[model samples]
Target chain A: MADVPSMEALEALLRRLPGIGPRSAQRICYDLLVRKRNLLPQLATALERAHAAVRFCERCNNLSEAPLCAVCKGLHRDHSLLCIVESPADLRAIEDTGMFSGDYFVLMGHLSPLDGVGPEALHLDRLSERLAEADLQEVIFATNPTLEGEATAQFLADLVPAGITISRIAHGVPVGGELEYVDRGTLGRALHGRRLLDE
Target chain B: MADVPSMEALEALLRRLPGIGPRSAQRICYDLLVRKRNLLPQLATALERAHAAVRFCERCNNLSEAPLCAVCKGLHRDHSLLCIVESPADLRAIEDTGMFSGDYFVLMGHLSPLDGVGPEALHLDRLSERLAEADLQEVIFATNPTLEGEATAQFLADLVPAGITISRIAHGVPVGGELEYVDRGTLGRALHGRRLLDE
Candidate 1:
């Protein structure tokens, strides 16, 4: 099997992907080479096209084919309201909800000092520039409710001017989640953040 | 995100791979485009190179970079003893054991009537031709122990000429397996195939 250089090379590349172990890489390689032969060229072409075209949006840092992403370029979105998230995947999740019609700034990652990630790595300079330049009225922190995310949010909040309103997305039990199954940390947050309801 | 044609195309192509769902595809796409941007061209080149170089072995139907696979071209292996397997993965598994220095004929897939695979799909014509042309003394069925694998082995056994020894790999409790945990069917087979030990 090692004699097949091309196969081994492809398998090694596949192993580099997130969540792909050696066995899984081998299975995927076999499936592509044998079961779905047509996909080989299609995937290759797709990779090349994406490599050439896809880039970070100049305004929001989301994935874009051009300088500005759809949200950044769109006329209808509320530019005054900005939601900061960790990644494009998080932005996509917020977009899929259809509840928010505002601009987004993707951090690309959180502030993790242990793993060597910091404000510079997250492009906080660009974020601060946008905050200073844009006439934003409110900025919502939609980062994950983790220690690093909270630290990043607090760090970004300090950089914003005093006039703008700053807020964090609520931490509570998920809509369809069971209270019995909820962890103590989430339960505590839900209890602490409980809001009064109108009769 | 919809405006990013290349990104969507790459994600769609990735989704076609085995075990990749929509969310996983998006995650992988982002990981490639943003996190490991260097992997994009590398993976594309690997795919193109593998597609151009890899093809079925003319003799054994295994994946090969040339007309004949390494095993088929090797002089040290026993050509008179042929081991039949379902796919290149199975052949690789056997090869990893450092045992069975014999020639192999890869069926590529087992007979699946529901899925439209038959003797023709398994390339029985080539198998029969090899059986007739080669002065083989023994043939080992190394196919999986599943129902389809067993049927395929039995079907191929009938094609072998008389006086040629035919054998199936033993099914029994695995080396580290406990009797309490062994499945009933395997336990039954193990009992039935029990051999006499010399005192």
Candidate 2:
């Protein structure tokens, strides 16, 4: 195996991918080399194409081929409402729901000082510029409910101008999730955030 | 997301890899595009390099940059003994033990009629040729103990010349495994194939 440098290099690179372990990396290496040989060129071409073409949206920081992402350019979406999320995947998750027809601001990542991710790293200036320029009446913090996400949301929330309303997405037990199976933190949050039912 | 065809293409290609699902594919896409942008070119280069340089050992069907794999070219290994395995990963696993100083033949895959894999796909012809050419005294079937693997080993065992001793690797409780936790089938096999202890 040591004699096969190319295969080793390929396995090492695959191992660097998120969630892929050593065994999985080797499996992928073998899969590319043997079972899915045809996928090699296609994957390589896709990587090249992505590197050559994909760029962050100038307005929202979401991945886009053009200066503005599809959501940013769409006329049907509400310009007065904005949703700030940690990543493009989150933005897409929100978009998939068909709820929130508002514009978006992708932070790309949350505040993690230990990992060296700070406000500057998150493009806070760009977010501020968008907030100042856009006639946004409300901004929704759709970051995950984790500590870092909450801290990031709080940091961004404080940055919003005086007039605009700011709110965080609720933290509660997920719909269709069993109460008994829910974690303690979530159950606590769900109970604390409970609303009064109107007859 | 659809507007970014390159990203979409990259995600689609990543999704096709074994064990990667839709969400995982998107996560990997984001990881490559955002977090690990530098890895893109390196991964692409690795894929290109592997595709261009990696070739199977003409003798053993193991992946190799050269015509013959290191094991096949080694001067110290017992050329009289050959171990048959299902994949390169299995071959490496056996090699990792620092035991079995023998040559090898990689079957690449087991017979799976449901998926259309058969004898020809496993390259039994090359195995036959190697068997005929090499002065092998014993052939060990190190194929997985699964149904298809057993069938493949049995099929290949039938092809070995009359004089060469044929054997399948033992299947029972693993070396460090507790007997209580072992599955019924494996325990049954262990009981059925129990060996007599010599004083």
Candidate 3:
């Protein structure tokens, strides 16, 4: 049989996401074909547009289409306090709460030596340069409570020139609960209950 | 706070795909940024390449980069037996089994009256047009075993030309089991146990 090529292509693309398996990819492909095929080209366009146009805030490591992420560029944002997160998603999660007025620096991921990722792997150098400007007072380490996240926060704490006050986001998030799943209440409490990083 | 603008743009694009909610989309945006913000630009090219190039198969609704879908343009496929399905996902599901020999004609959707979807809405006219010239011997109606799906199958029974033998694939699937979730054995059983549509 001359197999349909598009199906295979879509399957391959969907498989690259975080949780999708072969069956999930197939289901998505099927759903797209039947229910959203007209949207396929648009979807492809959107996906490409997302990938092509978007970049990270050169300073904060947050996803951005421009040279700077919106938070880093916003004039009204609090430059005095900085919030550090593991991913752009973390930035959004904190943004959704509408409580934090501070700016963000997205680490994108934690340090993983197994993958050979080290200090150079993260934008820590850029962050050091940014913090050296002496305008910032407190830096909140809001990476997730995972071990990797903890390690990354610690590394950032050690690296940020010792002048800035660095703190982690509250960890009352039930163990094993990801920031992606945590409710605003728990997150807000955690944020309110933030402990100081003495180092 | 200078927010990252590019992240916002990427998030908007990711919001358009099926099943991806706000948080999920943000997570994807973050994942890309964290994994390697550089990869986002590469992914953009892939998306554009896919969108700019992918076209529907003239005969089947399968995605193609050409005027005709790969299956339709293929010389070796069994044009004599055309398999009818509700969506492209259905086609892929069937293909995953590696059993069927014939080409497919995707319906794009099932018949749903309450939602104002009828034969015309689903492009049954196109199917009729294809039937006029194709040397199709039999059409295997492989829609879901739902009320709407069964109705669609029955409706097509009258619409097909008298020379063609029409059969349904419901007997092979289990009751209350969606083809999307059914295992290979059950789906195979359902396909092998297909029943006549004349009643």
Instruction: Sort every candidate by DockQ, greatest first.
Output: 2, 1, 3
* Chain B TM-scores of the candidates: 0.91, 0.91, 0.77
Which candidate wins on TM-score? Answer: 2
Q: What lDDT is reached at residue B52 by model 3?
A: 55
TM-score of chain A of each: 0.93, 0.93, 0.79
- Show model 2 residue runs off by greater than 4 Å: B112-118
* TM-scores for all predictions: 0.92, 0.93, 0.69
For residues B63-159, what per-residue lDDT tens digits would candidate 1 score against the true structure?
8898999888888998788899999889888988999998899999999898999889998889998787566999999999999999999999999
Q: What is candidate 2's DockQ?
A: 0.84
Give, for candidate 1 chain B, the lowest lDDT window spanning 10 residues: B128-137
| Native-interface RMSD of candidate 3 | 4.1
Tens-digit per-residue lDDT, B44-83, candidate 3:
4444454456556777887666778656776778878888
Q: Each candidate: how many clashes?
A: 0, 0, 29
- After superposition, which runs of candidate 1 have C-alpha atoms over 4 Å from their true positions? A133-135, A179-181, A197-199, B133-135, B175-184, B196-199
Question: Which ten contiguous residues of candidate 1 chain A have the minimum total lDDT?
Answer: A126-135
lDDT of 3 by residue, A1-199 (tens): 1344545665676677766677776666656554554665555555555556666677777666678767777879888888888777778778878999987777767898888888786777777777776688998998787778888888788877666787776556777879999988778877887668983
Query: What tens digits encode model 1's per-residue C-alpha lDDT throughout A1-199?
Result: 8568999999999988887889989989888887888889889999999999999999888999989999898889988888999998899899999999988999999999999987888888888887885668999999999999999999889988889999999999999999999999999999999998962
